[model samples]
Target: MACDREVRRAVSGLSGADAKVYELIESMESAGIVAVPELCEAVKASTITFVGFSCTFGDDGERSIDIGRHGFFERKTRSRTENLLSKLRDLEKDVRFTVFIDDMEFRRVWGWSRSQESLTEECEFQIELAREESQIPGDWDVELWSRVESRIECIPKVCLNTELWHQINSGVACAPINYEMVLKWAAEPAQSRALDEIARMRQTYPRNRNVKLSELRASSVTGLAVYSHAGEVLEFLHPGAIFIHSADHRRDHMLGYRRTKPLPIIHPWR
Candidate 1:
């Protein structure tokens, strides 16, 4: 498919680790969460732009990142973007870029794996019915969910386990060839603060209520998480669609790709 080829082309220069991160982000997007503007902006300003994504590395390395930090590079000229992307690609060959996913994100993906239908089912249920006051760990706001539910009410459920496995078995090149685990650690309970900020924004801002509401809900629903395989806490960041790796080395990064909508086929052949 031209689109699939284009998707591959967009991530051409990334290392296996970095590519997997992009794939995970795509999965989140497929599920209807907006792209992490910071990461997307960074990629756009760099040489490579993911026309779209569908797609890890594990090793010892030093990293400087935050658990929920967000930053973006200003748009650059084509030449500069290419140059920066080239440098990052070149550096990757020798330095080994790694994808450090958080346990929550790991669980999401893992839940898509065989033997976790129950977990995915539970997750889906929570996404659909859990309220702000619910004990569910990452429930979004009721008002936001109400709007989102209407938008995504009709999308079919995604069998992530089957689809992902099929892609892996078919030798899809959208993600890393190997699933490496650097460290298994816990994710911080920082979602509450994020939710609080969303509440404030919803109450204080009158413009673009639906858009803001959806985006705010999306932040809690399907943002990409950036983690460090070297086990370092990423710097602090504002409440947005971006996140840091983890709080300690025991866990490199935990990124949960959630959504109110159905997951899309990251790389379609047709």
Candidate 2:
């Protein structure tokens, strides 16, 4: 069977009919929580999987799989390690079937396969990381941001590629956001131009449409939230890697930077 080899290899360590349970426990651990003991005791199983798989790099220079691990470690000092690897771990879990896009800004690029079927319960990226009144005027409405979680079909899960780099604010960084519908709605009657820009780019880079919210290096890059706040949303187009270029490169970038064809105005994703 196509899955028998995988199932055999997966359960080789645990042995017996407990592989299904082991799979479930491992799934839980991949979300920053380790409840294996509870699962083990409840299921009357003695064997427990220590952890999920890890990324094994090779000289092939042509393939990669960022395993998504979110469980706490065994060491007492693992807390520090947790924070350090938080972002990286997030990427491992958020985006499934990940294929690299670029070496220069790998976080900025990735190919994603849709897992919309995984959504048993609705999970929105949630908007607004900060409290209200803390937000500046002309910026996003924080309270309004929270509502999108329940209302929208999808939400971006922003994060940096590395936690250590994120804490110190190192690197170009990115916020792997999932908010599109509400964000487009947030643009209001005036910001139709930005929405149009997003659509045009999306058409060229159709793959970017289903970005795994955790795969993109969110870092401190503004607007990583699900709603259309100034910082949580994509300011311009998504950064280069996975991003497709406009047919008219001369018209790309700020007004004066490109002295060619005028960029077209765009409305929100309808």
Candidate 3:
């Protein structure tokens, strides 16, 4: 089973955190939510050239990503594109309302662990066909349930638990490997605002590459995140929100891969 083919390809070097960014692009592309322009915007650059799809015949986007999040990257049998497809499905399912997800922020919560399904899975797995809206959390609960393409067993704690979220985030600087720029940003008190600003900044001033995270300092217990074109990364900074990313979700940065409309795996986004 050769890789179906790469629908898209991207290269990055901003920081290792970008490994997550590349994965995001792969997910979006495989999921059919992203194109060259969209990917460039998401990853903070128009410079990204796409590599065609890497999947083979008969590999549906659903099939490519059919394996649960873990099956994408953890297992050696599935290729990376397939892993991306799997995560793409997860992303569309987990935080459907979440229009924008930072690469680093994505990893913070969903560092890729084997567990039960998500709390949201409740509505999806019910034996009864019709579920009462009152029993669900929000208005679009039913719609959310309907979109649960695949289900994985995740416990309520792992799904909704945000107990050590901040504490774990603050430790990002101390992680086995942290971004030097993020470390520098943690020192500035006024930098707290910058963290939120950082996510959006990359999209706009990607060419600047002058705003050093080390220059800004943050005192409040907030999360900061970034992405790079590197490979195989875990952990990311959260901007204004905490516990925003889904746990027991895609390790897109660290794991997750599946594909549907496989790309050509082109070298650059020509």
Q: Write the per-residue lDDT of candidate 2 for residues 10-111, one digit (tens) a residue.
A: 445553434444443344232222222333332232321121111112123323322111111123213332332243233332211111111111121222
lDDT of 3 by residue, 119-214 (tens): 234323331222231221231112231122112112121332233323334423222323343344443564455444543444344543565544
* TM-score (all chains, Cα) for each model: 0.19, 0.18, 0.18
> Which 10 residues in a row give candidate 3 its minimum summed lDDT?
229-238
- Model 1 TM-score relative to the real fold: 0.19
- Quality of model 2 by C-alpha lDDT: 0.26
Best by lDDT: 1
lDDT of 3 at 18: 43
Candidate 2's TM-score: 0.18
Which ranges in model 1 have alpha carbons more than 4 Å from their true place? 1-85, 88-94, 100-114, 117-193, 198-270
- Model 3 scores a C-alpha lDDT of 0.27
lDDT score of residue 236 within candidate 3:
19
| Ten-residue region with minimum lDDT total, candidate 2 | 95-104
Ordered from best to worst lDDT, the candidate numbers read 1, 3, 2
